[model samples]
Target: MPETALLPDSAAPAAGPEALDDTHYRQSFGALCEDQVVSATNAIYAENGTKLIEKGSRIDRELYARLVQHKLRDPIDQQIGIEGMVNHESLEAMAAALLDQATVPRLLAASLGRPAALLQPLRELPLPGPIALKLTLMRDRCPALLQHALATLLVAMFLADRANMPTPLRSHLAAAALLRDIGMLHMDPAWLAADRRLNAQERRHLHAHPITSVLLIRQQGGYAPEVAAAVFEHHERLDGSGYPRGLRAERISPMGRILLLAELVAALGHKFGEASPHRLGLVLRLNHRALPGALIAQLLPALQGDVLASKVQVEEASQRFAGVANAFEQWTELQQDMKPGEVRGEAFAWLNSRLAGLRQSLTEAGGPPEQPSFLLAHAAGDDLHVADALALGREALWQLGSICGHALQRWPALADAERDHAAGDAAVARWCAWTGAMLAGLPGSSVD
Candidate 1:
């Protein structure tokens, strides 16, 4: 028996408000219809919250079947707007389209041991995972649906800013958001055995699903090229420690880099309800890891919004943070990639249009310029293992500033300090000589 699915008859923890954050497990087409009915009967909560299932009786397969059949409605074509072309027919088709995602259905089928139905239409006008979730929310619960839609859009804004994607690529957002967990849908019924324990096979199956999902998306061409790349690599690690393929930092796509922002927000959003301290760690790690700092920085605020989604009092609060995050994220990325010794003419002319009017000092008035301060810090500091570097750099800069007549008179002793400021301001002069020597690799005083 696996540890996750089951324990040796241990006492269960008390259950309280359960907010389902994992979209990895989705409904069977039948389950979808049932959920619609139960959600509809709840009526008020259903629309406001997104299609959420009530806490009781949902796990009962027989009850689910009855519920779906009761709620199922025939697609009735009618005008939804000025065109009078959007009606139940369109909505039903859309619903079916969402349900047909190969990732989820295959998992569900394998678990249920049932052959999939005629699901070809689902492949035609594919909606992204975020879009599909929104549609589900709308159909089953309107308010919840609105909340989800708003969050997805806001998350995307931050992601785009960081990824250098334009706003018009909303479809990319939809695809990435929607298709994120398609691979998990195909798990055996025993997999979710959410009761109390996990068997060995279930755990193995769980680890394998994320990789399987990437392949499933590939078959459908269901997502944008970058969107799919992100889905594939969202679980990958910066130190080449993550799964499916433990790809290094350089191989991951920009889209994959940014996709991690959304994944973190979504994954840990529910934990905030339980008041987990880990929420902050999850938020920080998604970007702090091998993901690109430029884009990930912009996403920080949006991820915060998702974390606070249930608790915030602000109206459409996501957009504001997203805008700020995106701007800085883009700025960071540009400086990182700018060539250290390239011509100002060709590089400047080629990338000028892509700059989006942000402030960057890529080249000096004469030609290629010195590196940006942040990159310089990384070059000088140890980056991931940067504690000593950070401390020493702080000390060095302070000493340098004093020498240049720019620093405060008194300075505190720092951890990385190898000597006291016993020499007072004259220490700055000594530090300058030391730094110059180190840069020239001449000897004498060491920097560490």
Candidate 2:
């Protein structure tokens, strides 16, 4: 069997706030100049006092090689300007278009008596000059990222209105959602590629984006401290599965929780297309422990209407579910054979707890894992039922993969003399093997 690439914990020390990498950003910005006007407002310099670009220089593809080699004294974003950058007027028009054309926004608007009120929070948001410049770069260079931000902002505002949050807090939530991913602009572009498998060092770089985002927001100077706090926690999961910091439950701020959920909703819609509402409902059902139940309850109402078919093959999905069930049984039997002391060790105990939670989630989403074939067979004739089964199976498989990843990452940290190292390694290897095989066969699976 081919070995699955398990993401082990990175031993590299955390990067300090001042060490933001802009190699990829500079390259992408220079590429942007090939089509549009981008120029330096102030002279660009390296850390050693060499001037890289003159104050009024027009940045183009020719300058990219020069800019990328140096460790810049100031971030390129603060020193450069793009023509027709995103401002309040352009952002409002974009939000208005999304409200008219997007299904999620339309559904959210239907819940409100005055759908136009949704755009108010976005309009009132304070987009300082630096923030507008970053947004413009994102729009021109990474259009999908900007769309995601706008989608998140719209959904977050809808939720905030439903909760009757004060206007100031609502605006802060909007800012948090809009700017949550600005840190990605500074990361290596290869690390963010959807099809690429990340090495541990690359994964570390990807995970530290939240910290980088917080620093950028602080540097921009107009956002509230809460906006930065929310941005920091946007990737966090309530059950402590999230990264950069594995904060759980109430340690995540109120606005942080809202942004996290909103981001998930936006990402799901982007990934699943017309069937996003259906897929999102199943994901929320299976991940109640990882997300806030109250937020889920509030969001569920918007997805209540009819959903388009997901186009997943029923027979193939059933077979995949059977494969997953067999893997789960194998892990359970392996656990039963372990010595009591080994089973009680911290590492094994943690893995067992997460697996147990997944088991419960599977049971709640469908029937027991053992009976997946039976349930799927019963629902074979109805497209919606079959789609639900397929979606549920996919989510369970993804969650299982996540458990294996966490096991690999946490094993070294949780290891101790009392733990059985050989047995633990073997168990994690087996789980990764099972997850990799299952994920390999499943279509559109993004667990890795």
Candidate 3:
């Protein structure tokens, strides 16, 4: 939880009552650009309700800085309001307006533009008054955060309606969607903007943001109990592959499952345009039993089109992909079993040369991040032949060999061999799975 601090207010100008526009939405903390004057809509009060900035007073740069510097999650966040700023009729309208410039899938955009079907079932639900308002304000403060929240909310609502959940339950799911990631505000902004992958410590911080958001909600009580739990468990996977608390399958709550799917849908919409559902289905298939089958069944309908036969073929190919992946896994294990020693120099050089060639082949074939064209399923009218499958299998083997050999070369000394070998094994396994998925045109499990 963020702690609150009291700072003396800056001196106000003697100029009485500056022209104020009630129509213009009030800004949140840190919203001041350079010379913008702060005008308070509500009486500014600290956590303890002590008078801070007067209602009609003008807030200059010094005061704005002071307020931001001493601000905590409580007093500062509670004092500002950006709700009703957009003045939209519905949450869907607000989401559509907010994401106008964003390239979302047509299905997702349509859902946001006119969510009557999605919102109808949730109409009777009594949401907290501040839910939409807070989300709207968050849009002004952090548009990216708002974008994710809105997408998640839209997906969650759609799921809830499909499940025929009651109004109260829907309310909890909706609130959780909006506030689940609020703790991200405490994270390092630079880490969020970094283009490269996060290191271990940075990943730890990223994972903990969910719990931080939960704690913030707990500290500021008003949200439903299920809301907090759903927020906390949103990152958890049904297969126990997720972080924080690796609760699996039956251990994860229904609301948590909804949130998990919602986040995945939102991410897919942001990454792939029209292919979001196809990509999402591929991911769900890649993970197998990690996510709830029921949730996927519910979501599969909203994915625009149903390629049931194609999906079945993809699943079958995944089985074949799994077999090819196992070969690489076993190969890695065999390498690890070898006695500690320097690999022959000529052999190492030969392996690196072969690895480079394989990587080039993969590139020319448009591999890894790019899946096979018909969801990569041969049954999906793709022309992949036995030779193509053989080449893909060879690519997987070379990929594993390259990873393991690199580990040995990087740490020939006995002291570092164990750690490097473990990393190599993990990397090879991930590579094989990814390579197989790409050949199959299926989404890899790592997409999460």
TM-score of each: 0.37, 0.86, 0.62
Cα displacement (angstroms), candidate 1, residue 325, comes to 36
lDDT of 2 at 75: 63
Whole-model alpha-carbon lDDT for candidate 3: 0.53
Show model 3 residue runs off by greater than 4 Å: 1-28, 31-38, 41-51, 68-74, 82-90, 96-114, 120-137, 304-448
All models: lDDT?
0.37, 0.76, 0.53
- How far out, in Å, is residue 100 in model 1? 30
Rank the models by TM-score, top first. Answer: 2, 3, 1
Off by over 4 Å in 1: 1-27, 31-153, 168-170, 189-200, 274-287, 299-448
Residue-level lDDT tens digits of model 1 in 229-258:
666666665645455566778766555655
Better of 1 and 3 by TM-score: 3
Tens digits of lDDT, candidate 2, 1-448: 1101111124222334345666676677777789888788899999889888899898888885667566899866678887898988898889888877777777788777577777888888898767888888789878888988998998888888878889888888989899989989988766666677765456667778887787677667787778877888898899988876888886788888889988988888767666777888999888999898898898888876547765668876786688668767878777777776553456556777777788888887777887768669767788888888888877777777666666656554322335545665556556666666777777655452
- RMSD (Å) per prediction: 21.7, 6.5, 12.2
lDDT per residue (tens digit) for residues 153-255 in model 3:
7778777876878877887787788788876665655666625445445666677777666665655667667877788778887756565666777766788
**Per-candidate count of clashing residue pairs (backbone under 3 Å):** 38, 0, 0
